[model samples]
Target chain A: MAKILDGKEVAAALKDELVAEVDRLRKQGITPGLCLVMAGSRPDSQSYINSAVKRCSSIGIDCRVKKLPEDVTQGDFLKIIDDLNTDPKINGIMVMRPLPQYISENTIKYKISPEKDVDCLNPINVSKVISGDDDGFAPCTPAAVIEILDYYGIKVEGKRTVVIGRSMVVGRPLAMMLLARNATVTICHTRTRNLAEETKKGEILIAAAGKAKMVTKDMVSNGAVVIDVGINFDESGKMCGDVDFDSVCPIASSITPVPGGVGAVTSTVLAKHVIEALKLQKGIY
Target chain B: MAKILDGKEVAAALKDELVAEVDRLRKQGITPGLCLVMAGSRPDSQSYINSAVKRCSSIGIDCRVKKLPEDVTQGDFLKIIDDLNTDPKINGIMVMRPLPQYISENTIKYKISPEKDVDCLNPINVSKVISGDDDGFAPCTPAAVIEILDYYGIKVEGKRTVVIGRSMVVGRPLAMMLLARNATVTICHTRTRNLAEETKKGEILIAAAGKAKMVTKDMVSNGAVVIDVGINFDESGKMCGDVDFDSVCPIASSITPVPGGVGAVTSTVLAKHVIEALKLQKGIY
Candidate 1:
């Protein structure tokens, strides 16, 4: 059996550290606060919100969920973001995706000040990620990938890593982050002419293509580290990953499973970013 | 002999178009203006400033040069930036890099207002480039590469593109731009395990890596579109590029020469970005 890179174990360890940090901050008269701005009623968003809130409470961090109605106007939404920006106590702000049909993400991204943008969804923070600078926070999902690698002792430096996706949130930023860590990263997408040929080169392959079972054994090399960032429904209606775990485990050295893998570590990273954001904003770092 | 992508010709043609636009803006009582901020006495920046000034004059755009003393304090330098940022008449602001030893790039990058950041140096503008949104402007060198390719009718969509280098100014932004154009972009850098092995996969190869003559004939595939963004000096004290001109040119279907290639197109693109910034600031875009 291949080494299942366990996210549950890593996340638990990370939570313990966060608890200590949260307590330390509380002693210094700082209470890290995260505001979750959710628009419309995405069932998935609600579940995600619940999980995030739970994680915040576990770490002794304050969590505020701002639920905006689906019919909220653009002006009203901007006003909400403005209030959050001025609220000195708020350390981090994360607006959930798949926002109301009328509100464009492009316009909304600027409203959330980069200082409070823990998710790194704000464009300035996005640019900072590309620059390999200290000012901006890394997006939570991509940061989770790094956390998982650090926990597993996987060497990203000088590795032939292939990222399967070109998303700004996952694939693009992750590639830059890996490069900052000294990895030679390649970004492959749906338009890639030879997906398997390209992916076979990866010593460390990250699948964020959002396609379930898309990566079979043939696509992976022997004993390569694989991370499944995709959350998809299989034919049996079960949540599976981009990599077919059963098929790939035999061929891979180590891999992250669907639910308990990257998904487990993402929210914890969000909390970590909140803490980091708080420190930077408060001139603690 | 490989077809040399003539950047000088493309730039000249672009100049003619910009002239017409500048006149149009003038008729509307908005003179398209660009303020070049040069700190210290770097010879390279001086020459670049001269060439940029000449380019602006030829295109009928207003160009102002703000030359600061090498020993100027960080506060004084930032004050100059603030003046330019608020100056409604100034359409674009170009800060010559390699600022004095004391000033940080991160601090200066933010000092330039995003609205007038013609080079896309501002973090918000940088993020906007990644977002592929309506507001942000693309940096000049990357924009030059695209312009050269578009002018030559080389297809980027669905192409296997390889970029050597990961500088925030060129390689990183170029990859995002290519990705936005639907290219399967891979970013390789100093730590890449097998640099040539990865670069060989590109149908379109871009050399922004600063190493002189690093890319040889073997690194490129036959008849590939090559764009070189390197400007270095050879042993003879003559200017050269990352790609070995004599060696790689024969194998490449199209390639840009160091002196007349990306360099010629860069300043024109910078001017074009200024016009864009002007339009955006005036609510004309």
Candidate 2:
């Protein structure tokens, strides 16, 4: 059976470090602050924000949520961003995804201050990630993957790593991160021909395709390290990942469970970004 | 024998299109203008700039070179960029790389306005390339590779493409471009183990490792399309590509030659960006 790479363990360890960092800053009369901006009352967004707020509070960081009306005009939405951009109290800012249809995503992405962009929505931060700038903030989800790998002592250098997705949020960014670590990285997507053939070649396989149980045991090689980034509900309503865990676990060397895997660590990564953003704002680094 | 993918042919075809575009803009009382900024007189940089100027002139676009001293201060260098940023006459700006030791390349990269960054040095442009934004400018070398593929009707979709090298200017950007087109892209570098094993799987192979004739017959699969992005002088001072042309040519289906391949098309791609920059400035698009 594959050894379980526990996300909770990794997140707890990270939280401990962040807690100390926050305490140090607080003693210096500085409290790291994060602001969550949401245009509409999306249940998903609300749930995510709630958890993020709780996470920040636990780490001794100040967290705020700005719940705007569903009918907020683009100009009004941008005005809020502008206010937060200059607000000394706010160290990091995260605007919830899938904003109201009327608001321009592009405008908001550009308007957010790069120094305060904890979620890395700003193109400047995104550019920094691509250019392998260590100082720039990476999106929370992708950063969580790297954190997990580091915690588990998985050496990425010279490894044949396969990422099965091409999203800006996860797959592509993760590939860039892995490449920076000297891994031979291959990116596969829905359009990939002979998917099984490609997946089997990876010493480290990452599935972020968002399809539950899409990766069967046949797709994975024995003793390969499998990282499932997918969060989906199987037909019976059980939370699952892209990999068919039951079958693949017996053959794989390691794997992360869906609920306790990447999902569990994402909010903590957000909290970590808040602290980094604070340091950037105060020139502490 | 593999068909020779002639770079001059592709460049000539692109030049024809650019010539017509420039003529149309000129008739509208607007001449597209590009400014080339160089810090010192590096012979290599001078040669590149000279060819670019000649190409721009041939395409009926105004090209100006700003030559600075070897010991130019960062403040003075940035002042020049600041002036060009607001200059109404210049629509596109390219700062020659390998600036003086006193100037920070990062500072210069960030200083150039995204609207005028024809060479895509600005991180904003790099971010756009990563995000698959079609509106943003791509680096000339990578864009030229895509242009050559398009000109030859070599479909990238669903192809297994391998890129050797991860430089921001070439491999990484080209991988992103290919991924955007639905191709599965694997990035291999110096740290990659079993390099030949990984490369042989690619139906489309790109060599950008800057090593002369590193790719041998055993490294490529039969009938694969090979593109050499290297511009190196072998021991005999003969210009060559990353591929061992004599050995691999018989088995490969198609290949791009060094002197007449990617090198021949890079300058033309720069000229295309000038037109694009002009259109963006005038809001013509």
Q: Which candidate is the best by DockQ?
A: 2
Cα interface RMSD of each candidate: 1.3, 0.7
Error of 2 at A276 (Å): 1.2
- Decoy 2 TM-score against native: 0.99
lDDT of 1 by residue, A210-263 (tens): 999999998999989999999999999999999999999998999999989999
- DockQ of all candidate complexes: 0.74, 0.91
Clashing pairs in 1: none
lDDT of 2 by residue, A94-114 (tens): 999999988989899999999
How badly does each model clash, as a count of residue pairs? 0, 0
Residue A50, candidate 1: C-alpha displacement in angstroms: 1.0
TM-score of each: 0.96, 0.99
What global local distance difference test value does model 1 have? 0.90
The local lDDT score (0 to 100) that residue B58 gets in candidate 2 is 99
Q: Go through the candidates in order and give each one's C-alpha lDDT.
A: 0.90, 0.94
